[model samples]
Structures are given as structure tokens and as C-alpha cells.
Target: MIGRPISRIKRVVLSALSVLLLLLSYTWISHRQHQINPQDTTIPSWGQLAEGAKKFTQPDRKGHRWLIEDSIATGKRLAAGISLGIIFGFLIGMFMGCIASVEAFLQPPISLLAKVPQTAALAVYFVFFGTGMKMYVAMIAFGVIPALAVTVYLAIKDIPSEMLDKAYTLGASHFETAYEVVFKQVLPKFIDAVRLCIGPAIVFLIAAEMVVGDVGFGYRIRLQFKLTNMNVVYPYLVFLAGFGYLLDYGLRFLQSKICPWYQNDSK
Candidate 1:
């Protein structure tokens, strides 16, 4: 146990150091380039980044306040979309996983639709949801749901057949067998599915936000890119990376608390 924690700490420290080194290297290169050609604002320096950070932290009416407000709004949108995707995915996936009829009836269409690239469907979503926050939610939910459903279907389908047979032999009804035997056996795996869905959901969120959003990390990135403000953009990218890490960490903590059986093997 001591060794495991030490190893994790070492990895985290190494990763942080690596990021710091890269940033320093970038700043150095950008500074050198700016010396050569004053017109090049492609790569921002440490001073510029400091200025960006100051602007971001300050409650300036013109600059930093938008950062806090936009971040909150974007977080809410991601949460809402991902939450809806998980619920819808769980139900559909559970049905397909447990019921042969459902699998036969819906799997073909779902599999086909899943193959359709999310970007390709953007125009369709915009047509329906009209380029608002609703479009963001729809786009994210659509992107996440198929992958989540497949994960769940596979998880449940892989449950040992003997367990089901035993439940049925003991006079359990279909619903009882599904809920008591199958669902109980596979509950932890649902958390695992949620873990898997989060990455793609964020991707979809960013894509939608870039196009339709008034305020989001993605929107900010797009805005900065056009302005050639690498300083602001880099920090925002780091914030996104940190956000993703924190989100996954929270889910892992939840899994450890709610699905203690998953940790049995660790002991």
C-alpha cells in the first residue's frame, strides 16, 4: 500500500515537472522568435502569460469576469448533457443487454447510427435545436450515448449464464432475475461505463461549444486562436486538462465509495 501511493506520487510529480519544462521551453522559443520578428505573436512569452493570468483572475468588467462566468456556464452545460446521456444510455443499454428481443429490435439501428460521425450530424442538430444551449446538450448526449450503451450492453452480456439459470431455477420471475441477479452483479460495471463515457462527452461538448456557445472554454479557445493570443489559449487548455482530471478523479472516488466490491481485488 505504501509503495502504491509512493509510485502514484512520483508519477504525478513527474507529470507536473514535464508540463512545467514544456511551458518554459515554449516561452523561450516564443521570446527568441519575437526578438527575430516583432510581428510574430504566434507564441506568447511568460510575461504575456502572466498578463493573461492577471486579467483572468481580476474582476475587470471587460476581461476576467467573463472567465469565471463562462466557466460556470460551461460546467453546467457539460454536467447536464453528460447526466442525460448517462441515464438514457443506461436504460437502453440495460434493455439491450438483458433482453434478446430488445437487442434484435434496436441494436442494428443503433449500431448504424453510431457509425455516423457527430460532426456530420451537427447541421441536423442545429436545424432541430437551433444553435442554442439545447443544441450543445443534444450534440453531447448524442455523442456519448452510443458509446455508453455499447459499454453497458457488453458488461451485462458478459455476466455468467449460470447465475441467471440458478435464479430462474429458484422460481425467480424475469424481472426479479434481472434486478436481483444481473443488475446487482453488474452495478459496478455501470460506474465503469460512466467513466468511459466522460472523455467522449467532453469532446462533443467542446465541439459544440466552439460553434454555438456564447461562453465556454472551447469558445474562448476559438476566440483566442483568431486573435493569436497563445497566452490565454494555453492556460485555458491547461484548465481543460485539469478539469478532465478532476472530473475523472471524482468519479473514481464515487466508485470506490459506492462500489466497494471493485476494490476487493486490490486488497
Candidate 2:
């Protein structure tokens, strides 16, 4: 009983310490930026950017924000990517984990495919798909799918033979054993993989949108970037940061609810 409380305290203390250290590092880096990059011409300081954010955001006070049409486009783009990402992740992960033949046939090519940057791959996808939300979702799914599949594959691979055996002895078929034994056991890891990928997927989603999208935040940023409108860029970046944080938090909450077995894991 005493040990449990002490362990919990240690975890909290360590997390706090880690965050404090990160803040200090950021502070140190910011302080050194002026001296080390005195010759750097184009980069704006954080303080200047903060003011720009205020300026950009103030436009919303006029009552009409960007465009409702653009908002709908962005939502559709996001949903499309998420839907495909999850489906591909589940399929490939299940195959790699449960089927040795499938894993053997596809593993090397997939590994090789993963080497090319998603940005590079998106160039061709955009060309074939001819841009818009379809291309955006395709790019986001490509960027997100491989890594998430590997995460799920590894989770499935970690299942012990003894658990499978126990289920089999109880008259379960391979499919049933997998569903009942393997699937339940991997719930925590699957949730974890989703949590890990959620942030990166959002980042890549914006990047994908910026490359080929006409109306999303990414497009907005790129358009303003051409105009050297730091005011607009800063607000969008702030919006992105908040959006990503919420996506991560949502995954965490879902993880907590679905995988109660892992509620205590520090990772």
C-alpha cells in the first residue's frame, strides 16, 4: 500500500520535473537565438509573432471568419484521412501479426516503401488525384498508415503463445481465439499506437493540405506566406497547435476509457 502511493508520487514528480526541464531548455534556446543568429535575416522573434497572432485573430471581430465553405472542406478532408488511416492500419497490422505468409510477402516492400518521404510520395498522388480533399486525404493516409500499421503489428506480435493455447484448449477456433485472446490483449497497445500517431497525422494532414489544398488552414498559411503575412501565419500556427493538442487529448481520453488495463502506463 505504501509502495503504491510512493510510486504514484514519484511518477507525478518526474513528469513535473520533465516539463520544467523542457521549459528551461526552450527558454535557453530562445535567449541564445539573438546572439547566435545575429546574421539570420528572415526569422521573426517569438514576441513579434505573438503580436502578429493578435492582429490576425482580430479580423474575426468583424463577425465573418474566413469562409464556412472552407471550414466544411477542411472537415471533410480530415475525416477522409482518418477513416482511411484507421482501416489500412487495422488491415495491415492484423495481417502482419497473424499471418506469417502475408507478413513475409509484404514486409520488405512495405519497409522499402516507408523509406520515401510522404511529401515526396504526395507529389505523384496529387498529380493522379488532381488535388482537392481527395488528394489531401490520400496523402494524409499514406503518411499515417505505415507507421500505425507497424505499431499494431508489433502489438499483435507481442502476444504470448500460452495465451493462445489457453484459449484453444477451451475449444476456440483460431479466429475466435484471436478475437477473444489476441484482440483483447492488444487493445491497450492499439490505443497507444493511435495516441502516438494522432499528433503526427494532424501535422502531416496540414502539410498535405498545404501542398495541394485550396481552402484549408494549410492553404491559408501558404497563401499568406507568399505575401509575407506573418500576422496571418502566426494565428494559423496557434490554431494548429491547439487543434493538435486537443486531438492528442482526445486519444488519451479514449485510451483511458477503452484500455483500462493501461491507465497507469507512463508512456
TM-score of each: 0.87, 0.76
Error of 1 at 187 (Å): 2.9
Model 1 global lDDT (CA atoms, 0 to 1): 0.82
lDDT of 2 by residue, 150-186 (tens): 8778887888888888888999998898788877777
- Candidate number with greatest lDDT: 1
Give the least accurate 10-residue stretch of model 1, judged by summed lDDT. Answer: 1-10
How displaced is residue 103 in candidate 1, in Å? 0.6
Cα lDDT of model 1 by residue, 18-89, tens digit: 999987888689889999987676777677788777756678766557579768978988998898888888
The regions of model 1 sitting more than 4 angstroms off are 1-40, 62-64
**Could you give me the TM-score of model 2 versus the true structure?**
0.76
Predictions in order: lDDT = 0.82, 0.73
